[model samples]
Target: MATEAPKRSRFKRTLITMFKVGLYGSLLGLIALVVAVGIAMSQLPTYQELVRRDNLGQMIRVRAADGSTLVSLGPSFGRWLTSDQIPEIMKKAMVAVEDRRFYYHPGVDPVGIARGIQVSFQKDDKVRGVSTISQQLARNIFLTSDRSYGRKVREGILALALERKFSKEQILELYLNRVYFGGGAYGIDAASRRFFGHSADTLSLAEAAIIAGLVKAPSNYSPTADAEAARSRASVVIELMRKNGEITGSEAFAAEPADVRIVPTPKQNSVRYFTDWVLPQLDTLIEENIEPIEVWTTLDPNMQRLADQVINANTPAGAQGALVALDRDGSIRAMVGGRDYVRSIYNRATQANRQPGSSFKLFVYLSALEFGYKPDSMVEDKPITIGSWSPRNNNRGFAGAVPLRQAFAQSINTVSVRLAQEVGFRTVADMAQRFGVTTKVSTHPSMALGSSEVRLIDMTRAFAAVAAKGVAVVPYGIRRVTTAEGELLYQHESDESRVLVAPHVAAQMTDLMQAAVLTGTGRAAQIGRPVAGKTGTTSSNKDGWFLGFSSGLTTGVWMGRDDNKAIPGLQGGRAPAQAFHDFMSRAVASRPVEQFETQVAPPDWAETEPDEEVWYDSPSNQGQMVDADGNPIAPPPAGEAPLTQTEDPRRPQQEETLEDLVERAIDPERRERPQVPPRPAERAPPPRDRGSAGDPVERRSPTPQP
Candidate 1:
């Protein structure tokens, strides 16, 4: 009995010693934890300092004309809302989804930490996030987004400090205003505006639920990135809200995915091209400062979408396409830089300088009209040689005499060159510059054929000038610039009285272009409306273009390989014109139909006299007269020499006479029937007549006739 009692006492002593060691160990661990927390807390900024600090970088929020955001350049923030200013539903939704024990916990939730630790142990020690709202705000304002044990410890200390310093309402308000959402939005207000096109105070239950769901994975649940995923996430938030007693079952059921209307984001980031083009101009408009600014642009979201769709759909494989649309006043309505913005950001519409081909004939024809040539005036379309450069019609044969309208519509190379010669090359270049083409236009003969490279936007703006009935149209994208506080910085204003062309001249040019779209090379561009446009195909088919205007809108399209290599079987009248047709058809569906002004009547002196029955040896077919199709035909029973006409009365007297000019331009020895060379191998079949429905013909070489 005595031995048993001694043993029992020893057992009690052992139990007591073990209990004392465990208590000392726990107290030492607590002291270490407190010291570590003190160290972390010492490194953190005060809650007040964090609240006042603006960490967001320079933000440029670009919006469409209707006040919808097209893109945000940097971290975007909306108005800072106080506790009361925040919607109750938003608060509940966020609390329910992010941390159900947020109100009960003193900064850190023990239950959540324990659960997270268990999960980590089960998952091979992988770190798991168990952040509450306070922790998120601390991380957002005071720490980087690093997933490490050290970061987590610091985050917890900062959250505890925040909880002690700020009231629950203050913490929640700060948390809501400082969280990052997808798409560059930095706050709930900005996110609400970005995703739903409205303010957070006006957010419905469904929108609040969606915004709350984004806290877990912003990009994965971003409404703009994937509406379906966003709504699915929102459903989880709704269920959580119901379980937390934040909402009733009926209310949760009522929050349908369809009720969550997400603003349509630009597909393929195409709107970025427009935003990128406008971003640089901001420096010119505003003072250099880091202050957040808002730029109201003239972009029509619908038209921009359509432009993107059409350009991507019509651009051929192994090539790229670009498009630009402008209102009559030159407000850039839509722009597509390339087939895919992500693939290439080199904005072809504004940055690329490419030959407009026959589309450049607008200036030549406008100059001719200014020089007393009417649409009905007769012009010879025979092969002509100038300084060893013999330009031929696309079909290798020419129409001997045709109306200026017919020549323009057919995109006749010979007729354009003849008119450029008559009007003077310098005059054509000057006309182009005066009409809004900013590119340096050369006085070379090929310039009359659009060989000079120019930007699509400039070409579209030049066409807009014609549509504006002589008024100059300087293409502009930004409508106004303002500070985030709504202080106006700059507003665009244009002079309406700055006429670039005479109304009658513009009307005549429009008449010629209308003929081109109606019955000429641009027939493919007809949009079941009064569309006046011209087709352009550069030499070797390296560039294809269609510039046109209908219903007070001017749009230009260009298609080609980026390397400037020739695209097989490409023509401006084919893919480009069809793209134009497809885009404009949908673009102008809601607008009222309008007709172009009646063309000025031809002057008395412009009337065509009876032809003197001119005949010329076919450049091909060996001295036989060929038809428009380049086929040899029976010669006229009574052939006559080429007709000779008097000088135009409008020609300056000091200008060289036609006969002198012709003598100087042509080599007398090489004029008599130059030897015909055999046709070279072709990548495509021989082009059909311009009037045929087959592939539209275009000038294929810069020098030497076919």
Candidate 2:
């Protein structure tokens, strides 16, 4: 018994010695770990240096005259709210969904880490991360989204350092402001403005919960696009808040199924096309930096909405349309690029180059007026061929020797051809180009009947230039740009060049266009007010347009298929004219109604006539009027050798003009295209008295030709 007791005592002593050694070894190992962590922490960026880092990426905000935002181009948002400024419910939401034990954790959650490791090993799910809120902030601020081991280690280490340097509130604030909430929103304040149209401080409990749920897979949980998944996720968030004691069960239930309707930001609308257009201009105006700048634009939200409604409601199925409204100064007040911005982002208003049809006649007439043609000039609308191309008017009819004003009003194709041939085609093409037609013009007699393709915005601006009384006007949007602190950055300068059209010529053209509204093919645009405009329909009804001006505003509407298919019965005077009438009616509703200025005065040659013979044309007078220099204006006699028809004797069968095969060939139905020949109507008599074309007039029929 004594020997057994001695052996037990020895074993006990040996166990005590081994226990002491192990305890000391563990203490040494823990001390070594502490030293290693301290060294690592010292190697990181200094706390002050880290806090100084900033990324307030610019959100180029385009605003209207009323100080309301139209759209934000980059990193979109309003203001930054500190933790104190943020609502308590928003804070609770963040803590409940992101990290329940945020207050207790030093930097990393050991329990979460253990679970993550087990899940990774069991299911090989690398995405089941154990990143705490601080770690997430570290990743967002200083790291890429790469899933490398190096990134994770750096994230954890930075998280620990952040926790040591910042208090709990600071860490949470940093996390809230740095995390992305998807949909181009980068912070809590940005997300609040994006989905709710208010500041973060104004977020309701339901809004807070909805945004909280977006912390994981924001796009999938987007309430705007995927409301079902977003609501389900919000319900999960409310339940989590209840589980974490952040809210009561009643509160969770009340907020779970809340009907969330997002007050959409204007940035989501088709006006984004306008903003995109102006952003590149800003690039030249301002230096690139993180600070945001404000651009005061010429957008009228009311008019813009009206335009969008008109286009979306009026366009045919699977068809596209564009509208542009500009003031006399060439400020773009409203622009709708397409029917819907989501389906197609292309800005048809400024980018599309569709044929202008009869709308091109405006410049042709303007050029004729500039070259000393009176509004009362006479043109025979018979089948007068020009070269191989024999253009024919739509509807298979013609007026014999219609007054120039009547010819333009009726859109008599033969008359336009005669006029273009009388005044050099170069003069007409030059006039259109000067008035802002950018497309290459064919100068064929067909061009006089609107044969050139032009962007809607450019054509509208060209008309706006005329409304400005002959001063060339460039359409501008951004009026002024300012820094966030209200410091002047840049201001727009107007290029009001007056070299495009002559004053007398513009006045006369305006007079003739008003006659068009009174009795012309554009009768559909009658708005119970004096207006000046033109109608255009391309070959095959492929494009239709109405460009008009009212109350010092010019708006153009273009309709066509992106695939260039003919629209049945679509004509410039049909849908396009009516749509222009609707848009202008609303656009001018708030302004005082006024008549277009029709300042009629005698031409340079009218003063030469005596009182008794003033209205009489002398035998010495040629077909053309003289210029200010009194040089007797002479044009080649109107009847040129009747243009011979191009003949093809190969098998002795068919003959066609180049323009017939090329520009005007697509129309199987009557596209209302221009003419080379046509059935002649009874000759029209000269009017008893010709006045300025502001009001409609009746003319006696001329001597009929067999």
Specify the highest-lDDT model's number: 1
Write down the lDDT of every candidate, Cα atoms only.
Answer: 0.81, 0.74
lDDT of 2 at 88: 87
Cα error, residue 152 of model 1, in Å, equals: 9.8
How many steric overlaps does candidate 2 have?
13
Stretches of candidate 2 off by over 4 Å are 1-56, 77-79, 85-88, 121-127, 202-205, 257-261, 264-267, 600-706
lDDT of 2 at 97: 88
Per-residue lDDT of model 1, residues 1-706, tens digit only: 9799999999999999999999998999878877766676677666566555356778877899889978777887777888899999999999998988888887888787778778888986865856899888888887898767788777887788777767889899888888888988877998998899988999899999899999899999999989999999989999999988999999988888667789876554789899888888977887887887889999999999899889989888899999999987789999999988888999999989899999999999987777666677767788776666788889998887788899999999999998887666777888889987888987767778988999998889899999998889888999999988899999999778898866777888899999999999999998888999999999999999999999989999999999999998889999999999999999988998989984655444334332122346545645564332244445544674432212212212223433554554353342221111112111112222343532223323111121
